[model samples]
Target: MGRPTPDYRRYRCTIGGEVYTVHLNPRHGRRLLDLAIATGSELVWATTWEQYANDWIAPRIGLPSLPVIPLTSDPPSEHGEMFKTPHVAAYAGRRPFVWFDDQVWAEDEEYLRVRQGLADFLLIHVDPMRGLTSRHLGMAHEWLTLTGFSQGS
Candidate 1:
């Protein structure tokens, strides 16, 4: 009748054949919100706010309504909302998601790094005054790639 309900908060869709069932984490791609929007990706926010899409994020990124997920918990950062579910990695699909934060996913778990193919494990870190490798995220990406999890395309 209509689009099937979203199974994973983030997932690469395959049920309908060649279409990609994917959801973009607004918090994770705030900077690339415009990039994602331009790419026809969806955005999820947990609470209502000034229409960033209609006003700024959309005009720049060229998309809108990028649906908000509506959070029932505190935002992970002061600027954005938190993931609807912390353990919901399934929604994130198998893509190497890059999230903006002052910290890593887990500080005590050796950062659960993972990679799948010869895709150059990459992360475009954005900081006003820092280089692309800020937060040493590339280091983590490298770690994942080196571990034979990622093939580095």
Candidate 2:
């Protein structure tokens, strides 16, 4: 019930002209997502998966259909953040947020830091190969506690 391993169940993926396999232990993800949701954190899809996350990944991970962040064909950020960073920042729009992604980079953090100003945020980078873990949830919970969200604000 920790990181996803090569020996875990495999799911084939053929999206965006890339073909690969993903190994997942859905229980861990389900548990983490459930806790996040229960603690009043809104979950939204901000991935290339887009609607497919609601159609596929959510069900497997026992999550309800969450809102999808509509990605644009806009160019990358001037500061060299991920292509999705601008859209994510726009969607978040001054609200505190915690973004989780496998591709999060320092540039993305910097962009959000500058964009959000005094608003608090956290970025949890999931290892594409290893998947999420309790430690990741611990980080989220700790952030929530420090931000006063754990008390159900």
Best by TM-score: 2
lDDT of 2 by residue, 1-153 (tens): 445675457778777788766675768557766767666777789988889777767777678898999987786568877888888888888666778788888888988887555357788898886777778878887787778775456
In model 1, the runs with Cα more than 4 Å from the true position are 1-56, 64-70, 74-90, 100-125, 128-153
Per-residue CA lDDT of candidate 1, range 71-149, in tens? 3444564323224323322344454443433222332112223222222223333342332232444455445455444
User: After aligning candidate 2 to the native by TM-score, how far in Å is the CA of 15 from where it should be?
Assistant: 5.3
lDDT of each: 0.36, 0.76
Clashes of 1: 17
- Report the error of model 2 at residue 18, Å: 6.8
Question: 117, model 2: CA deviation in Å?
Answer: 2.8
Q: Per model, how many backbone clashes are there?
A: 17, 0
Reference-based TM-score of each model = 0.30, 0.84
TM-score quality measure for candidate 2: 0.84
